[model samples]
Target chain A: MKIIVCVKQTLDTNASIEIKDGAIHAPGSARIMNPYDEFAVEEAVRIKENQPDTDITLITLGGENSRDILKTGLAMGADRAVHIIDSDLDDFDGLAIARKLYEVIKDREFDLVLCGRQAVDQDRAQVGPALSVLLDIPAITVVTKIDFSEDYSRVVATRQIEGGAERIESPLPLLATCQKGLNTPRLPSLKGIMAARKKEVVEITDLPNTAGSVENDAKLRILELSLPPQRKSAIMLEGQPLDMAKELAQALREKEKVL
Target chain B: MTDKSSIFVWIECQGEQIKPVSLEALHCGLQLSESSGQKVCAVLFCGSKVPDLSPLSDFAPHSLKVFSHGRWQDHNSQAVSSTFFKMIQEQSPRLILLPASNHGKELGALLSGLAQAPLASDCIEVECLGENDFKVKRPIYSGKAYASLALEGAGLHIITLRPNVFRGESGSATVLPEADINTTEPESLSLIVREVIKEAGKIDVTEARVVVSGGLGMQGPENFGLLEDLASVLGGTVGASRPVVDNGWRDYSNQVGQTGRSVSPDLYIACGISGAVQHIAGMSGSKCIVAINKDPNAAIFSVAQYGIVGDALEIVPLLTAEFKKILNG
Candidate 1:
């Protein structure tokens, strides 16, 4: 079995994000693999543990600093890493990014492709599904659990919906975007880190010129970016627990009218 | 694709009723149609037996198209997107609106890729600018900022609207004439649904009118029972911050944060929550917020309309008992 996992480098979730020059600037923010993508990498590694013949490859498309995440993926047991370095890639939208990813691995023989449900930064949750469409494969998003059939020909995936779970079975060569609760992503062990240092990191510079490709052009253009309006300070209710509860209840009924 | 005109809204139906978010999308479509002077078309996918379409008549859509198949019982993005692709090829509507549910978001992305259309996901506002253009406002940077985007293209413009933000309205109860119904079975479905397990009769945090959420301050998993009690008393739902969920104190579905469910309930009560930016991103849209934490400087207080600097373990039971007495008496 062969699996391809998509990983991205994103700002740490705990970083205090600030707005500077109409864009987000988290000063001294440490870059880590997307928290959700770690689940994808872990799922791939677990599959390899069960199926000894399974090969896991990590792919990422970004600038120079992106390889850090790929290296992290390699340390987490991915067999190899593919880095598509394009300095001009920062301006691409989700759809264009999916198209570029499709261009890179459309011909590869893989039974499954996995990605995080959504990146923390953009929160679009579009890339995996769009890439699946481009590759003409079925996609299940927000998947929490996955199991392979006895023959490894089909996989049963449990996906999270609004208030429930849906169990879907798909044949091989499907795409699944993983969500939380899928598994506890393991930290890279000392031995794994040592092995990763010796592994190969393949860098590719052959990207199709997206200028002539109509489908590769960005569909949505950002006209302006601004921070959300600051909220007013909370009106602190001072009193005993009973009195505070009474006042809160009264406020809910009289002022907020939510009760 | 010759000068597209009509606005098509995807109406998600389970059994005989339309989903609330889909109704909101329908209302959005109607509003856009008023400016575009285009017909508002409602697209529904139903199971083997076609459910009653009369429930949607109150909204007074110009036309209703039903896609009935056996496999439509569950959400199959591949099958649904295929149907939508065929519809787009046939009608070529200028605009497409869908609810920003899990299925809607996935289908919107799939259709956008298949149709090569510009898509705005989880949009809070959308306006149909004339001449094949639309302006949309959506949260970016994990709700830290809003990006005003313009979709200008020759293809369909797709927008998935966030639920609870768009107001739904019903027009005169006039039945819409049924347009062409497609009964084609999805071709070559690679995915199959094995089973669907749902938490029966429990209100989802996303759709709940009120939410009572806890965080690391809740101390442990058993402490969430206090939140559940309060939620039940208030006829609301129980939620948890990412840390609580990460600590295995609660299910991921109950997590309210940037990476979890984004909720905009009428009232949100944060108990013992420190209010990380990630968590605030999800519930900041609530109409009113109340925070109860021992720390006065908790970030959650900034967005909270009401605050009580106290221990959640002590205050939650008292608040729950008070509400019970007030309501019961």
Candidate 2:
């Protein structure tokens, strides 16, 4: 089985975001592989562990820095990597990116494709389902549990929904976007890190030009990026715990009326 | 097809009634229609038996479009997407608004892909720039930053509005036209839903008016009983920080953080939460926040409207008792 795992490099969640000159400042921000995509890579590696013949390939689309994330995926045990490098590509929306991804990997022979539920940067969660549509395959999003049939012809997946879960079944050549609680992703060992240095990374500089449709035009344009408005200073209530509790209760009833 | 412009809203049904988020989207759609001089159209996908559409009459949409397919009763993304896709092809609406629910997000992405339309997801605000143009505000970088996006093109503009952000409005009851029902099965569907396991009778934290959230300071799952008591008194829901969920102290559904659900409740009480950026991103949008922790320097106090520097274990029960006294009286 050949598996393609989509990975993206994102600003570390711990890093404080800063907007400068009408755009998000990327410099000085620590960039790591999107936290959710790590789960996808981990799941793919586990599948390779179970089926020794399974081949895992990591694919990414970003600027020059994206190669680092692909290399990190390689360190986590993907067999190879593909980097579609174009700074202009960053301006495209999720659907265009999905179309480009489909254009790149449509002819490749793969039994399964995996992606993160959503990128922390965009928080769109659109590419995986859009990619599945472009590829004309079945997709299940926010999947937490996946089980393959003994013959490897079908898969049963448990996906997270609002306030509940749903068990779904689909045939092979399916796509699933990973969510948290799927599995604990393992860090790359030193040996694996050293081996990743020699892994192959195929880079493409330009995307295929099938671009006359209205969808090919960038629909969503970023006008400005700004920090969220800060809240007013908190009123620290002083007194004994019981007294404070009474005061808070009175405030909720009298002021906030939320009680 | 007529050249008349219309704004379409996807009215999501939960059992017999409309979901609050979908109603909120309808409100947003109505606002957009008023601003752009377009008509408001509500689309409801149903099963064999149609839901009670009388309640929607209070919102006074110009028309209601019902697409009934047996498979739609269950939450099938393929069926919903195909139905909406067919409708979009038939009626080229100027804009499409959907709730930012799980099904909505999936269907939005699927329809965008199938129709090659552009989508703005989880938008907090939407503005009609002109006839076929829109400007939307959405939180990015885990709510730390807000990005203003402009959608301009000849094709359809799609947006998934976040819940609780838009205020729902009701006008004088106007009898709406009979829903135009279309019963068409999707051509091909490879996925099958085997079973659905729902968490019964639990107030979702995202929709809760009040939320009592615990964190690492919660110590263990047993300590959550105090929070449950407090939540019950406040008629609210219980939530936990990501660390608590990661430690297996609570179900993932109760988690509030960057990876989990973003909530904008009326009142949010944080107990022992240290307020990491990830956790803060989820609840900072609350209208009023009260933080209770032993540590005076806990970051949660920064965004909280009120702070009590004390032991949560001791204070939560006291607050619950006090609230019960005041509310019951």
Listed in order, the DockQ scores are: 0.63, 0.69
Return the number of clashes found in candidate 2: 0
Instruction: Name the best candidate (by TM-score).
Output: 2
Candidate 2 residues lying further than 4 Å off, grouped into runs, are A211-218, B1-4, B184-188
TM-score of the first chain alone, every candidate:
0.94, 0.94
Please name the candidate that would achieve the greatest lDDT relative to the true structure.
2
Question: Which tens-of-lDDT digit does each residue in A129-155 have in candidate 1?
Answer: 988988888899999999999999999
Cα RMSD, model 2? 1.9
- Tens-digit lDDT track of model 2 for B92-133: 887889888877888888888887888899999999887668
**Cα-lDDT of candidate 2:** 0.85
- Per-candidate local distance difference test: 0.85, 0.85
lDDT of 2 by residue, A145-208 (tens): 9999998889999998777888999998999999998999998999899999999999989778
TM-score of chain B of each: 0.91, 0.94
Which run of 10 residues does model 1 chain B get worst, by summed lDDT? B1-10
